[model samples]
Target: MRIFVLFVLALSFFGCSTKVPCNCKCPKCPKDESKVFVYNEPEITVYKEPQQLSKAQVYYKKQVSYVRKKAAPYWGEKAQVADKFNYVKYAKDFKARTIINFQNGVIRVETTDTANPLRTLKEVIASTLLNTQNPETVDLFSSRHTIHVGEPFLFNRVKDHDGEPIRWVWRANRYAQHLIDTGLKKDAIKTSTGVKKRYYVTFKMKQDNYSNSSELNYASIVKKQAKRFGLEPALIFALIETESHFNQFATSAIPAYGLMQVVPHSAGRDAWEFLTQRPGQPTRNYLFDARNNIEMGSAYVHILFNRYLSDVKNPENRELCVIAAYNTGSGNVLRSFHKNKDIAVSKINRLSPDALYKHLRQKLPYKETRDYIKKVTSAKKHYL
Candidate 1:
């Protein structure tokens, strides 16, 4: 009985003592399985907008200052300067907000409180339109004011814009109710960083008469970046079309950001280092800027041409490889031809530009990358 008791005691001690020594200075040792281990990542906040030259010189201007200390746009719609051309601002009380797309000449306003919704909505719309920089670009007086409400009962009341211009149109949108419900639910959830954000669902506003003339929204920036990097502006335009369709706030699960879909770790890090002679990942706000996005994307294309695929003989053929490299990588472009780098370069040089395009379309590993190269090349002609 004594020997059995001794063996049981030894097993219990060994089972509970399976902890390894840790060098961390925390009060609790992390190596111990019995104790809880929690790791909280630090949050990044961009305080200032990245400076870049613009032709129009229309900077981001706030309409009204918030009384509750409105924070900068942090991956939310509450207070986001979507891009140089678009802005989103929420009222101090969080009951009302406005989304203004200057390029497209559209203004959207949402109010949570249905009581006197028209009054709140009208005030917000008028204030936003008057205070916006470059009022000529938006031309809200000529542009249509579309007010959407989820509540069916309020649609008639809201449409009574009382002595306002005929431009005010109210529509009943069921999605608006869904948006409010979703925002309330999000407000209830606790965040890991202990910071709660209210996210209201937003819809794409209809384009006005002004959008047709403003098709090439960032053409000036494209020209400057292309000239600086020895690239055709048409190619940049094509890439923007294929990548994000010119959506400045576009982000992906791969975590690529902005107009050109630049991955911060890969293309962003390389382009930023090359441009500034410093090594660091660009913040979200930096990439969100239309000028900075085009510059970084154009710079990466330049790197692909001059650094990686420089050995290829024909500039046109080299551009084909560059496009593929932009979607995939330069290594994969080489691999598409041959396993060895030297042999791949030699083989690529031997093929005519047309032949190289055909080979790439057929041999590239990913169907998406293969399709990507074709889409960019095809879209390039539209810009030209």
Candidate 2:
């Protein structure tokens, strides 16, 4: 019994004295199986497109500069450059230019020198009919006497409403019917100027009904991509509305492309790498495609929410960070509170989401980013 007791005590002593492996799960002595938080950030490189403009782009730029200097046309006050969907064709032979603002759905045709302006105008109309992607039903804005191709739903009263004589009016209507026969019903006409003279025509693609609403138009794609990326469809919708006003071919001075206006060098590169596990710059054409734009944009949002700003404890707070970050960046979001990332994260975690939102709104570096957060958050409600 004594030996047995001695053996038991020895066992206890051994158990106490022997350095047992720590199972406390502290940071300093992490277990072999424990996960170590590692950020696998992709190495970003400068994005450069092939230094060649298509023939169409060359003309578009030339005409845009001329129009900016002379006509003072409204291509949406925000549009800096002609987007992909916005067509501007300059016929060097005719010295005529045709411009389309897809965002505002306005079309304009002007010529400094064209012998037969009517023929040139007809050619421009024909091209639009052939190539332009027609909206389901667009309300045409124009003067009375121009070619009225499609079925007119709502007619804007022409201020001066003067046209050629009765025979000319009849001929114009018949000619417009001929245009309709040639496949141009979706987007019709309102001519601001005469078909004769130094012809100038301006027409706007107006929204008449729910059938042509941009929200309903892109709802399916937004829902699909949002589901794929674990994002709110409302959030995606709001972002698109804010970024491009649902203009899929939207471009920015930063040279960001498509509906979400993704900058290829930063957000686009990161998101593409995340999705493909490869490094490559997305072409303007690729980003212009609605699916590609939303996919990449949503992927970047996922990165902002789940990866870069994941340290933020509150989901709502994290989203605020994401909204600001989408406009600026994660680094900027952190810097809004504290320059040091670790301290900023700690501060963010401690604050209520509402407090964090206030802090962000007040302290964000750029007024644009500050305004952007407000816009996105407010716009999100509509989608919801």
Best by lDDT: 2
Each candidate structure's TM-score, on Cα atoms with residue i matched to residue i, is 0.53, 0.62
Model 1 Cα displacement at 48 (Å)? Answer: 27
Please list all clashing residue pairs in model 2, or write none if there are none: 105-205, 142-190, 143-190, 143-191
Worst 10 residues of 1 by lDDT: 39-48
lDDT (tens digit, per residue) of candidate 2 on 261-349: 88675577767766775666577667866778888898888766765676787888888889887887666577667755678899999
Error of 1 at 282 (Å): 1.3
- The runs of at least 3 residues in candidate 2 whose Cα sits more than 4 Å from the true structure, single-residue gaps closed, are 1-80, 83-113, 129-198, 209-212
Compared with the true structure, model 2 gives a TM-score of 0.62
lDDT of 1 by residue, 226-272 (tens): 88777898899888877766656554434466778776655776677
Model 1 clashing residue pairs (backbone): none
What is each predicted model's overall lDDT from 0 to 1?
0.53, 0.55
Best by the TM-score measure: 2
